[model samples]
Target: NAGVTQTPKFRVLKTGQSMTLLCAQDMNHEYMYWYRQDPGMGLRLIHYSVGEGTTAKGEVPDGYNVSRLKKQNFLLGLESAAPSQTSVYFCASSYSWPPGDREGTEAFFGQGTRLTVV
Candidate 1:
């Protein structure tokens, strides 16, 4: 399985520009998520899908959107970029997390998508 692969390992965007970062996994996992990491902050969830055709907003869903049309792919779209969005984006998946405990689940992460907004 490819696990997860994110396109455009690095990118630069001017203020107000837009971009879409692609994430694909071959594990056939049912859950997928998009998160952003900033200095001194832990990964903050932007959006997630429990399964294909289902999407949900997360803790930090503002300024971002997500789509899960295919079972193996999750796309994160930034319509208007801002300097505050200049952070490392990470896409993660899990085959199955340990039941009954959220912390017990191990999430597999992609290399990362770095976006710089001037």
Candidate 2:
């Protein structure tokens, strides 16, 4: 019954280091998303996937990439981590809603992964 889980609760990186954040869910959801939150700010979408083998960019996709090779897992990668990318990242998944009818849909969120770039 693990809703969602993110690996590496915390990490520190140099200005140009590279890393990947792993997210896994057992909910069998059709939609998955990656988001980042700065101190005292709301979450900002980084990338997302609609289903297995499908991915898309979200509000703040710069410096980040994501993959959904399997239906139950999503991975977010920082090719060259930057100081500005330092933040707490979150992973979420939701059941599919009908096209053009996304009302009242909710997602389950992971605890979070904190990353710092210096």
Candidate 3:
């Protein structure tokens, strides 16, 4: 089973261009998140959804939006790409928040989506 899958593993976008990254999981997780990884900065949360049809802003929400229309799918959209938006994006899903030693709390991540905005 594909734990988590991200579409378009790599992409190069010009300024003002728009694109959407898709994340899908088959683990039946209830929490999903979008994060970006830059050279110096570690993972920075972009957005997250606790369940289907629910989404919330994260650390860096500007220039990006996300939606969880289905229980197993999450989409991150860039309205207008920017240079600073260039980064490796990751999608993760977990069965619980504040992950602990509890079963199913461990997050499963997708390979990753490398995005470059020029």
Winner by TM-score: 3
Report how far residue 117 has shifted in candidate 2, in Å: 0.6
The deviation in Å at residue 54 for candidate 1 is 0.7
- Model 3, 65-99: lDDT tens per residue? 99998999999999999999999999999988875
User: After superposition on all CA atoms, what RMSD does each candidate show versus the true structure?
Assistant: 2.6, 2.7, 0.9
**Candidate number with the higher lDDT (2 or 3):** 3
- For 2-93, candidate 1 gives per-residue lDDT tens digits of 78999989999999999999999987878899999998999999999898999999999999989999999999999999999999999998
Stretches > 4 Å off in candidate 2: 98-105
Q: Estimate each model's TM-score.
A: 0.91, 0.91, 0.96
Q: Looking at candidate 2, what is the lDDT of residue 25?
A: 93
Query: Can you write out model 2's per-residue Cα lDDT over 2-95, one digit (the tens) per residue?
Result: 8899998999999988999999999788999999998777999999999999999999999998889899999999999899998999999888
Cα lDDT computed for each candidate against the true fold: 0.90, 0.91, 0.94
Q: How does model 1 score by TM-score?
A: 0.91
| Model 1 residue 16 lDDT score | 98
Instruction: Give the total clashing residue pairs for model 1.
Output: 0
User: Against the hidden true structure, what lDDT does model 1 obtain?
Assistant: 0.90
